[model samples]
Each structure stands twice: as structure tokens, then as C-alpha cells.
Target: MAARHSRKLLRPLLYTSAAAAAGAGVLYISYRPRNIPGLEAPAVPPPGYREGKLVPPSFPSIKSRLEQIQDLKRSNDEEEYDLLIIGGGATGAGIALDAATRGLKVAVVERDDFSSGTSSKSTKLVHGGVRYLEKAVWELDYNQ
Candidate 1:
């Protein structure tokens, strides 16, 4: 009679243990790390830290650069700029560069500092125009 009672009690325990073990197995399998092929670390270092070569950033590093920047600021404060760029964004900087290259004096003034706005955000993309690339390809002759 006791053996019969013990067997009945043991049956539920065994089923519970088996179910728990199966759940744990499923969890382990589901959460296991999968092996992906062809994924690799970057081969090239990012700009400014080029392939173990250290490049110092421009700032108050030297006295002459500081003096030059101060002189430019003073000049901007005193007189009107020929090409006054309001922002230090890519567009403004590019315009300034283009104007200066064409022999026009340019001055860029930013409320914050150069590249302190959305220009400094890493989430933004800087890509060559897709249409320009397509046009160049279209113009190319395969025979050449």
C-alpha cells in the first residue's frame, strides 16, 4: 500500500522535473550564440589616427596659430567681410573655400564654434552625389 502511494507521488515529481529540464534546454538553445561567417574587424584605422601615426589637432598648441586666429577675429570685428558666412556648417565652409579660391576674401563666423552644431554629429552622412556618379558613368565609353 505504501509503495503504491509513493509511486503515485513520484510520478508527478518526475513529470515536473522533466518539464523543467525541457524548458531549460529550450531556453539554452534559444539564447545560444550563433556563429556568423565573413564578419570581420575594420582593416583601416579612422582619420586623425592613421595606421598608428598620431596627428595633433589644431588648437592652442602653438603660439603663432593662436595669434593668427586672434588677428582674424580682430579684423572681423573691425570691418565688414567681403564674403561673410554666418555658419560654420559644411555648406558655409564650402562656400567660403570656393569664394576664397576665386580670389574673394571670406570670413566665417559661428555663434558657437566651427563644427559645433549638427556638423559635428557622427550620425549624419557625407556622401558624394549619386546622380553625379551615375552621370559620369553614363558619359564613359566602354571602348576606351
Candidate 2:
């Protein structure tokens, strides 16, 4: 009976030791220091960091709608715009802003107020519906 009890205790101890060794091996392999390309700390600090301090970028002041419209008219009379975006909805406004930031002359023409169209009616949910995907596939609508 004593020998049988010791065998049972020894079996558990052996298993526990094996598990601990495996865990340690995994931890060491994962945490080992090694030089990895693109993972190294940048020699030069990124933009906006000066002398170990973060400096926020200065942005131009927001222009009122009237001012923007006047500017648009002035630009239209002076020179042709590189891009003319119709509608000031989320997508259109975003594209306009992106183009303008890239040094392109962009003008956005909205029927009504900005975001008053379909953008304002959005439920703000970002999800891919299986039913919509099925419909798109069945109808051969690649745009969807």
C-alpha cells in the first residue's frame, strides 16, 4: 500500500515538472532579446517629438461656410479647380479634404447643409450583413 501511494504521488509530480519545463521553454523562446528588422527603436525620434517632449502641430483656423463659399467663388473666377466634388456628405467631404491636403484645388458643392443628407440618416453601425452580401452576389453587383 505504501509503494502504491508513492507511485501515484510520483506520477503527478513528474507531470507537473514536465508542464513547468514546457512553460519555461515557451516563455524563454518568446521573451528572448534579438535584433529584428523594422522592430528596432528608431535612431531619430518621429515628427512632433522635440527634445523628449511632444509638440502638437499647428493647424489653420476653421473657415465659416460664408467665407468658404466666397473663397470658392473667388477661386472659380480666378482659375479652374483641380477637383469639384458634388455633395458635402461624409464621403464627399472626406474626399475633398484629402484632395485639398494634397495641394489640389478642391471645391465641394452641397445641395443643402453638410451631413443633412444620407450621412445624417445613418444608424452609425459598421457591419457586413450576410443578407446584403448574398443579394449582391446573386445580383452580380460588384460595386456592393
Local accuracy by lDDT, each model: 0.66, 0.75
TM-score (C-alpha) between model 1 and the true structure: 0.33
Which stretch of 10 consecutive residues in model 2 shows the poorest summed lDDT? Answer: 119-128
TM-score of each: 0.33, 0.38
Please give, for residues 50-123, the per-residue lDDT of candidate 2 as tens digits: 79998866655778888988988777456989999897776777677667666688888888887686644543
> Across residues 104-126, which tens digit of lDDT does each residue of candidate 1 receive?
77867766656667645443222
lDDT of 1 at 27: 100
Best by TM-score: 2
* Clashing pairs for predicted structure model 1, backbone only: none
TM-score of predicted structure 2: 0.38
